[model samples]
Target: MELRLTLSLTAALLLPGLAIAADAHADTAPAASRQAELPAWEQLSAEQRELLISPLRDRWNAQPQERARMLEHAKRWKALPPEARERARKGVHRFEQMDPEQRRIARAIFAATRDMSPEQREQFRKDWARMSPAQRQEWLRKHPAPEGGRGR
Candidate 1:
């Protein structure tokens, strides 16, 4: 709902006290400087460089604003404590392994709950916690992931 779909996972990596401060002006001088010092394609690790390759080899330019946000997010990720980093890595890995349909369902669920009031959210949590494992499984089976997968 807040349009943080791209970096929500990255933001979740932060502990409450250490969450990166939101910047109203993303094109600030420090961000510009960081972008200027971004590593060249050849300088990145194989996995990092691979992210730049388009499946169709389409020509594109990375927007400076987007690049700055990425670098900022990376800096925050690197600064996380080892335990936090490991937890974040496991979460990201799990998300990556989800099928398209599962991902679509997850996104929908996220959107649906994103703005819930604290009391409503707490009640939902309480209801979930009250469910038995078998009940949870049955509920999931009844509400399967979207069949059509993601939409354009």
Candidate 2:
């Protein structure tokens, strides 16, 4: 009976360790496969990849409702003329280049703009358009850039 109890206790301790080892191996195995499958972009360091793709990818992978909204917006974007797409891509590049604080303010502005009614959005656009370049620069000056570099 003592031998049996010792064996049982040993098995109990060893079994959990084995299971944990198996789980760790299993998890890493798939990640390795995924890394292999990833494109050149995925081969980049996480920071570089995030810098290049996070905004659109995050938008795409947001919660289901938000994802649907983003998809709808993308469909509309796709329908835009090539020149418009190029212009929009330039805008996105600018946004990506902004420091974190500026990006945060821009995100807030976008959220507020998106929440506005069509007429309100149009009014905001008109107001923004009326601002002088100096005024726009001053507005941006109020928001400080993030330290320690942009989100990698």
Candidate 3:
């Protein structure tokens, strides 16, 4: 079943001309008639647009590589089971709730993790999984920010 879904997704991505044709027809309708189209993201309340679709829209409009990657991510998301999709949506919401400094720290951690070898990463993950709440707090306390401060 997974293989069949994977094949379907692969075919859809590889033959995007068909998708473009379908979207072209959809786009031909009068702009003012499109009720579902969102206004500028900044105009909406944060709760109303949790994930900030504006960044995705800007990337889609300006960067072909980023647009392609986003499309691929969307396809993969669509292929996920409903439960997995819900979990992913929750994760995205959590990410959106993070402050800019927290987000930057998370991104840096991710980049550092990505640079690690698979075996090292697995060991790190295992060690992290084993850490108790107290131990985690202690580790953070020991790793205090530099003289200026965390953001600095």
Candidate 4:
């Protein structure tokens, strides 16, 4: 009788742990299924293909380093959440719409602000918000594009 009671107690303790493990496993099932369903290269649409291989003809040979970098970027991009991916796509679209001069100015501003502390960045935002459009234009004029051009 004592042996049976001990066995019963052991079962009771293990049952909750088994249940918790099963719940954790169930939560990951959807992500596992998603990973399983990764599309083949041929299955991609033309637009998707263009996005994957834009501005690169003969990517296999002409720019091997760039192609490798792009491949790494693609892997990281695929790991992003849906909302983050959407926001990035929108940003790219907005950047594409800018003229060369505007692009240069925006890039310069972004580079200048990239490493700023949170407080410093907030102060900059406040100062920018206080600027008139003409003042903003003048600021861009003062900080012309870096010499020797920008790439990457």
Q: Write the per-residue lDDT of candidate 1 for residues 69-135, one digit (tens) a residue.
A: 5556568878878887776665455546666644654544443444667577557556656878787
Question: Which lDDT value does model 3 have at 42?
Answer: 72
User: Which candidate gets the maximum lDDT versus the true structure?
Assistant: 4
Task: Single out the weakest 10-residue window by summed lDDT for candidate 1.
Answer: 13-22
Tens digit of per-residue lDDT, candidate 3, span 1-152: 21222222222332222222223335555657653675666786774454444445655788785576668767876788887655544544444466755444334334334446768766755665587868745644564323422112
Q: Each model's TM-score?
A: 0.38, 0.36, 0.40, 0.49
Model-by-model lDDT, in order?
0.49, 0.47, 0.47, 0.52
RMSD of each: 13.1, 23.0, 14.0, 21.5
Local accuracy of candidate 2 as per-residue lDDT tens digits, 28-133: 4565796675568646687655555555665456656556655655567668787765555555545545665555445434533544676886686666667787
| Model 2: pairs clashing at backbone N, Cα or C within 3 Å | 47-152
Candidate 2 has an lDDT of 0.47
In model 2, which runs have C-alpha deviations exceeding 4 angstroms?
1-67, 115-152
lDDT of 3: 0.47
Stretches of candidate 1 off by over 4 Å are: 1-61, 111-124, 127-152
